[model samples]
Target: MPGKPNPVARLFWTAAIGCPFGLWYGPPAFAATGLALTLVLMRHLGRPRRFRARVRRIARAHAETLALRRRQESFSDAYGNRIEDGWLRERAYFLDRTVLPQIGPRFADLAESERNRMLAIVEAEAAAVALPEEDEAPGDGIDYERYCAERLARAGWRAHRTPPSGDQGADIVAVRDGLRLIVQCKRLAKPVGNAAVQEAAAALRYWAGDRAAVVSNAGFTPAARRLAAATGVLLLHHDALDDIDLAGAHRS
Candidate 1:
């Protein structure tokens, strides 16, 4: 009994070997052993909870990253581009691909918390990306864009200003009822030319916009109007702005 350990002691030494026992002795050794065993047991018992939390964090982070990439892509599908709506771009993509369908006719409900959480994410990401400048419509180009955005918003669109430097061709993005329309606004004293319509068509391809348009406060050149008709790009002149329907643009 003095030189050889009992069967129980041998099992205690090895059964849960979390603590270093050889260097410990007396009641202190027993205390250390108990604490070690408690920790090991707690870890084993809480594994599922830890795993769930980790998975949730990873999923949220992944969603955020994808949203950011999408935002960048709007600027010529690269970085360092000028402004277009930062928020609507991200929100619309998720809304179309994920949110709308999941809650529809599934017998499943979108909890209020889930909706709020999504908004929070979109807002935070949008905010992190700085607007080109604090100044509103720094020049003629931006001024026309601002005008177009206001009119579009009044027409029930969720409008976003595309970045100027990296605009893939769209000056403003108008979204309504999950429909995305890319618009190029011309603030020239003369009529907008055919070039405007061509640029808008190219932008539609790059942005995958449902419809494209060239909007002018003045008027569109005859060539521009014809090209728009052929290419299916809407031409919004000052007089026709009143008759244009924002909701209908989404369908086009």
Candidate 2:
């Protein structure tokens, strides 16, 4: 009756809605019919290879994103460690990344000395507030490296601790009197040895600086003195500070 109630249409509607309900029940007919229809529709909509390719592309993109994030995190960790080390070399390396990028490409063409000048201004502007107290006893000869930095700064030079990995013997670097100089400071109570002079000479060669100097509270040994003279390394005795202005130079 009623033209058999359009059996195909009735079955289609039943399978469409009833398949979900069949999940809870035991109606294999509704599920099978719906699954078969879905497959037919997908086959007509697109080629299987195309769909598979799209899925593969998405997977590859996700992998690349993950790899990039990992690399960034690793770089961040290394940078943090370098800063925490509190070495001049470490600081330079970190600043090269964070500070250099902002000044743009013009800096790339500058020589090492010129580049250092630009960096000094930037570093000075961001100078940190020192702690309230001094760490060492008064007049107990300053750490030679720190002492040189203080002295040069007083002389209106921009001084910074340089990396010591292959330093050759230079402990500090400074720009002074329109010249860039590499300095080796010795805090011994006695005269420095010729070996130290050799080290300073090596450092000068390594840095290719305009000049090199050796500063020691303890005067230079005869051998050291001879080498310094022969090699053109400026020598400064500990008592030399009495003759120079050290207002901004490091103390304690």
Candidate 3:
């Protein structure tokens, strides 16, 4: 397709065409030509600004997509086998292969400040997806449940600890965007077992929740992970709670 007309070139052509008519005719002709030129100028005046705004919106949307991909990849790795420096390597590869190629050309016309601002937006989004540093477990399982609830609350979920004794299998119940998540929290030295996964899955049905998850300070046993996969129960590190997508969990 042919490219759009250059504003400067269009202005020059308009003036070139109108000048002779104005000279050949009288004041009325001159007034009409000037009005036409003004209208043309007004039409193109905001084109660059609008184009830049569109580019910024595209950049932000791509940044958000990259963040989501990173979170999903991290979640998968944490579930199965976590590799050292995996996230850093994955992020570098994504920026080099995906983000730069897609957004780089669109940014060519943007001013330095605007370009920098978009880059900052991308970095901020990526940082948000980076998992929180591991923290010491809370004093007891109840404290850990409360801690997870607080973390979920910060992430926009209305989360609270379930009642102690007869709360079924759910240690925490969180609701967000009309999705209810039943979580079984385990503060353990050993890997969480199949029982936790079983409880979380059962709790989801018993509590009429949209999704179920088992959050733990320790890793999950292979059997528990398999059971969770079969039951559509999320096996998450407590640190991963902030990045959970309630809708995605429900679908899973």
Ranking by TM-score: 3, 1, 2
Better of 1 and 3 by TM-score: 3
Backbone clashes under 3 angstroms, per model: 11, 1, 0
lDDT per residue, candidate 3, 115-197, as tens digits?
44544544566655544445655858778888999999999999988889888899989999888999998886566788988
Q: By TM-score, who's the top model here? A: 3
User: Candidate 1 regions off by >4 Å?
Assistant: 1-139, 238-243, 246-252
Cα error, candidate 3, residue 25 (Å): 82
On TM-score, who's better, 2 or 3?
A: 3
- Candidate 2 residues 1-252, lDDT tens each? 321223356557756777776676766855676777676556534533443343334334334322322221121121333221112332354346544454344333332444454334333333332323422312333455776677667767788877757667888777656667777877653556888778878888887777777776445555776677677776664334323332222211
Cα lDDT for residue 27, candidate 2? 62
Task: Supply the global lDDT for candidate 3.
Answer: 0.69
Tens-place lDDT per residue, model 1, 1-252, is: 232224455446543563455245556776777776666566555644543343334335446444443343232212444434433444655545555454343212323324555555555544565433322222377777887788778777888999877887899887888878898887654556889889999999988898888875445555876787788898764334434664453211
Pairwise lDDT winner, candidates 1 and 2: 1
Clashing pairs in model 2?
Answer: 150-250
